[model samples]
Target: MFDRHKSTPAFTRFTYFTFTYFTHFVRSAMTAFTLIILTFIIASIFHGLTGIGVTLIATTALASSYPMSHVLVLTVIPCLLINLVVFLDGGRIVYYLKKYWLLVLTSFVGSFIGTKLVFIIASHHLLIALGLLIVGYVAMQFVAMSVGKNFKLPNTTPSLVISGTIAGVLGGATNAMSPLLVMYLLSATEYTDDPKTELIKASNLCYVVGKIAQLIVL
Candidate 1:
């Protein structure tokens, strides 16, 4: 008599393969999700301390694997909320707005324009641009530290306009403007009693504005 259970059916092998594939897929997906969350947490902590790292950290860290467009989308909300919290944490909203109204206006315009370009550009190009932006910022920081930056810009209309527009465009395009704004505020407030506060306030203000621009365009 032929043994009825002697041989495995093809369906058994197919079912085994499917189950293995599904299990592996689920595990891999969970791992990726966890790592992404971990990256965001680290970035958030750094931003809380420095008032600038969320975008810089997230953008550079995730850009290699994820499309820059998706990374920016992930970044836009958290960055906005963090900046709002930080900016409000210090208070004096009236003072900051009054002082930086022009800066805010110019940044809004530049950010809006820059954000519009994001949709038109290719994802790979945007990724490359973001990578270069981070690298350039790091290089500039190195130069500033090693060579000792001494020149100071007066916080005049011209300086504020230029800085605000550039920072806004940079923030809008790459979602990392802290490097430029940090350098700018440090240079401009050589005589302020509380330079650190000024930096937090100014940078957060610009960041908030740039985020608003991004949100509007998006």
Candidate 2:
């Protein structure tokens, strides 16, 4: 009677198991939380030093442990804010928009479609594809440097639309469009007056729209 009133054997064992599970859960949560904090801190530092890496770094780091969809959702807001700061601070917005409105619109469409595909396709396949894409980009860059080839991007309307659409799809799927954007901008023969500013303005415009689409979709 006294044992029953105090605690039955089954109840005591269950209580112990629950406590142990809760403790493990808290520890795991804290560890993940700390890792996220450090990752973003480093990502932001790199972004400040260079003009890129906020979303790329954060997404790559977090996606290693989390689901791609969750990683995308987590980084969207921060990426949006960062892109907005770069874009708004760059100024000459009207001229840039006038020159690149088609690119921007195409990017929006591509990003929306790509983001929607995140739900349609299995994320692990996308993750593997993303890995391959990054590797391919790096390899291409290395080859270009080895061959001393300056890739000249065609400034035709088709090229502009195609580049923007591709960049947007990649950005929506992986959130690492900075490299393509940089490559696209650097290859341009025009915009030599203030290439850095123009590049930042153009890339961030696409980034802003892409993030907005992500927000809308997810």
* Candidate that would win on TM-score: 2
Writing each residue's lDDT as its tens digit, candidate 2 over 59-79 gives: 888989988899898899988
- Overlapping backbone residue pairs in candidate 1 total 0
List of clashing residue pairs for candidate 2 = none
lDDT of 1 by residue, 92-145 (tens): 999888877887888888788778777888878877777787888778778778
Model 1 Cα shift for residue 121 (angstroms): 1.5
lDDT of each: 0.79, 0.81
What is model 2's C-alpha RMSD?
2.1
Per-prediction TM-score to the true structure, in the order listed:
0.84, 0.90
Superposed Cα deviation of residue 54, candidate 1 (Å)? 1.6
Stretches of candidate 2 off by over 4 Å are 1-6, 147-152
